[model samples]
Target chain A: MILVIGGAASGKLDYVKSLGYSDSSISDGFIGEEPVVYNLQALVAKDPEKAPGYYDELVGKEIVICDEVGSGIIPATREMRDAREATGRLCNRLAISADSVIRLVSGIPVKIK
Target chain B: MDFLLTGGAACGKSTYAEKLVLGFPKPRFYVAAMRPYGEESFIRIKRHRKMRAEKGFETIEKQTDVDEIELPPHSTVLLECICNLVDNVMFDDQGNMYDVTDRIISEVLTLKSRAENLIVVTNDVGSEYSDYSAGVKAYVQAIGDINIALAQSFENVYELVCGIPVVLKGELR
Candidate 1:
């Protein structure tokens, strides 16, 4: 699977569209049969440990966009910390197995892998 | 020469910066900007030492006022995590509440002049949507502005993600 990761509002959606992913091919995470999933943090936050299995169920032929929530200061609440930690772990896993990994910074996409 | 290495928390920027320093000459200096103030910081400082253990780095703890620091000639220096230093300087016990970006940058340039290569590690902490306090917002603005200014000064800039380096301003050496 291709992983497009960036911070919130960093234009992951636009980059995916630039890659020729049409609107019909994009879904919000585990809701549609679309090949591209955006805002994947919502899914991973549910169960970060199981996120790898969930992504694997996509058959490794999909494109996923995950917002990076791990670069800022330590969160105030335990729940927020858990969520960010989960996102970090899941993103690392996806990056390792991704066919290509791209990080978007203010709308510019940098190929990382 | 100056290089700025940036990334989010646990993104391997420190490890990569260490590798870059290793590629430079001896008398490598690691100017740790994080102060050993609280429990969390103490743990972090120890962990950082463990990360750079046996790596031949003469670590110097300069939690604030880096502009006054002087370094040996022909040495490679790494200033790890500049955001902490900004906090120590801006939000001190005296609470002067002044923007110290220009002074900090000038001091950093002074240190740069003393070293052969200065590699700095900063954070990408400007995208959160939640409303923070006036001080937190000001701190964020300060660091964000400082990153932009430093990027202009540094010859090479890199951002790390998932232990991988993405060239930002210049080609990786």
Candidate 2:
């Protein structure tokens, strides 16, 4: 699993695609909904026994790309907070399971794991 | 309550949210929705993460589905972008659009109903050109509708232009 971090137009998606994953497989254009949970579940459904082993899947078969979103402030509203919390927790879980982590800046790549 | 920050591409919605997080005294978790789909994007994501890590910011990377995770009530969360989240959900299972949308909305609402504070980032794709492919048009429309609904639910809504935050609804203070 690879945790990719960057702001808008940071080219995170393009980086993942360069690693050789199909556009459909590695794309993250969820228009109006929360996608991390569903994407994780889809990965789990692929292999129930290895569902929790997201890291294992990334070892050789493919690179799991995740967005980094911790550069901002907390929203004053409750719902916004919840979404942030949920997204943070999911990223943390994946990071813990990931073999490597990377951060992007102005289209630049830096290894952090 | 839900707080929706929507704007055009490169409008600085993510940056504004980041600024907000920096103001909080407590530890804040940044939820990133970006993925490296190609070599160019890969480098970009890596560089950004490096910058945040240097600043001592702890991050979480999630692509889709948020209901199964465990979150801290005391910590504030910033959901970088809803557009990617929606794409992940829609692509997961094309036939399950209704179920996926409903589930996402419910989960988002649930998060707001339980968290101390939440900030959501999304794109205002509706204000741009609308004469793309049919599928693309539908996708844009769906996202537009979702953004509107999110704004309705959120108490604080802002639209960014040239990196400036124009308050659309509710006061931040």
DockQ of candidates 1 onward, in order?
0.39, 0.02
Task: State the weakest 10-residue window (summed lDDT) of model 2 chain B.
Answer: B92-101
Interface Cα root-mean-square deviation for all models: 2.1, 11.5
TM per model? 0.78, 0.55
The residue-by-residue lDDT of candidate 1 on A12-113, one tens digit each, is 999999889899898886636788888888877776666666656543657888888877666886566667766775676677788889888889998889
Candidate 1 residue lDDT tens string, B1-173: 78998877766678788889999888898998886766656766887799789989999888877767777778899998778778777876776687888877887777777889999999988756768888888888888888999999989999878667888888887
Measured with C-alpha atoms, the lDDT of residue A77 in candidate 1 is: 69
- What is the TM-score, restricted to chain A, for candidate 1? 0.87
